[model samples]
Target: TNNLAKTACINIVTLNSVAFYIFIMSASLPSSMRKLVVKTLTSNFRKAVEIQTVPLPNPASGHVLVKNHFVGINASDVNFSAGKYDPSKQPPFDAGFEAIGEVVAVGDGVSQSFIGKSVAHLSNGAFSEFQAVAGKSILEIPSMQPQYIPCLVSGMTAKLALQESGNLKPNEKVLVTAASGGTGQFAVQLAKLAGCHVIGTCSSDKKVNFLKSIGCDHAINISTENLGQVLKEHYPHGVDVVYESVGGETYETCVNRLAVKGRLIVIGYISGYQQPMGVATTTSARGAAALPVKMLMKSSSVTGFFLFHYANQWKSAFQELSDLYVAGKLTCMVDDGSSERKGGFRGIDDVTDAVDYLYSRKSVGKIVVNLASSGSKL
Candidate 1:
């Protein structure tokens, strides 16, 4: 009897709840508000977003409207916030490299098949509720490639910069600096897949364990010990290739230990980014006492990489990186936080906290900004 009574109580409560919801929803909601709620909510749809009502520009032929699902925040975004990067363009603009959104509308020549498709794409003006899309910058991710979204957007260049410049071959030995950084982990994993013996360098002993967990055969602590001696002990013949993400004294140390004909791929200037207030500012090839390259006598080549400049070729990089990722050979580590909210930015002001974090070097790997939680405003 008691069991029957409990079931009856549950049915009553569920019915009342449904009835209340029906009453609330039956009221005619404004078109603006109805447009706001797109997804079929589950478990109390919890998300905070900055909404903007823009004049709906008709998608030109070959264009589709993208209603963003997830936006990626990268170091470049932080740099852009701080006014640190070069080649400035006109302002009063949207600043973002990539966003994943579903198509809400499409222009002529666009197929109806794209109506509900999830897309991963590069674009400016992505840190918002909606964005106008240009079809050329977008690509539909097939179901099989769903999991590769984070890596393909955040760490894609990290992979290509190494593969293209490292000239990695099967069974060659490779070492990566800042191995636990966003790009570093992927570089190490990619090298290992190429059958290379992988060594990783990190600032902390704790990071070394994470490195080793993901295909790094060895890890050196760059913060405390002598790097050259450590490398000599582990890589007796020296390492064949290096993905140089953090440059500085580390670069000098790494350059000294390169095997003859080794290749050094330069992907970032993280080492020079922050110097204390009183320290001498570095200029001209990033400062240090001059070293005679002739003395090392190695045929190693150093190549620089800048992803945005390769904008025309982003998908090629994404496709290859995605393939390796789906094969279970790569990992992307995200240091996600609420920079977007804590910074209280609207429009351009949104970038401040993220910029501060990057300059502070307060986090590791790809620092992701959680826009939903931060209380910051523009």
Candidate 2:
């Protein structure tokens, strides 16, 4: 049998005349060298990022030093780079949020047994070769492949948004807009798993087929079909739960299609992320009455959901998602599309290109960038 584990090699890289070593092996336990991905002060999603070798720090007490094997790319990564997440935030900062890695070293008070365990993490510095994550943030997994990284963010977010935010119930009618996206794909499957009849919206026929393959009950090509008409004619009673992300007109449509006592969970508004940031006006300004009034009339509710804010329950959510995957109830579809400049984003250097491809809004599933991994053959 072929062992999928690949060996990691140490590389000496120079940044501004200073040379630093990346990925120090146990034999060379200096613990003073590391590598990180950074962006300049004026850099945005439209600009390129830099990979620089820096002084690596030993794991702090109760923390584990992990050698990252794979990192998950999210739309939030683009928003963070574009200065939309925090306008006051300056550059020369590390990017990325979720990753899967193996514990190469442990800090004071941590067990040495963690050294070889593969785990998933949601830490601050994931877009690099290594991350010293606090022990509590790690979720032990069976594989270190880049594909599993999406389960940390997109998967957990989808599970929580439906179960916690939407209060999903079996046999209910559920609707997910942007249903072919990272989180949306998971939402579609999870809703189906819960015995809900799912209606997903996508922009293209390819994505429509992708959603259908994943067990989505009804896939609507919003680019070609009239969404409002489809809902009115086919689902006159409206849907029970709406997992909404794309805002603006799509949000309005979802709101209008809410069944009595229905719940609408707002995850993000990707429609406005690329545009100039500004204060948002109420629905009444568009000649439509207040959305709250409409919700009140139907005895429905609208709530917002942000996964990071519910950090305490992340592990529990991941546990359920992992079980589902292990039991063959959940599947992750990864989009391997390339940008105009690169054939495929197989290395860290192609992150910017990957982000650009995501913004093009053409991918059908989770978009991931594979990191070169070096480990003992299993």
**Model 1 CA deviation exceeding 4 Å by range:** 1-58, 81-88, 142-149, 274-292, 338-365, 370-378
The candidate scoring highest on TM-score is: 2
Between which residue pairs do clashes occur in model 2? 7-374, 8-374
| Candidate 2 lDDT (Cα, 0 to 1) | 0.78
For candidate 2, lDDT tens digit of each residue in 118-160?
9999977688777889987789998875567668889989988
Off by over 4 Å in 2: 1-24, 28-43, 86-88, 279-284, 287-289, 338-343, 373-378
| Candidate 1, 1-378: lDDT as tens digits | 999999999999977875565455334222331012212211111121123454545568988877665555554553443335543543333455666666666688877456657777777666655566877778776542324445655567766676567778888878888788767777887788778888888877778778878878988887787788998887777778888867666777667677888887777756554432234433434434443472247877777887776676678777777666666656655554443344322232243344455445444556544333334443
Model 2 earns a TM-score of 0.85
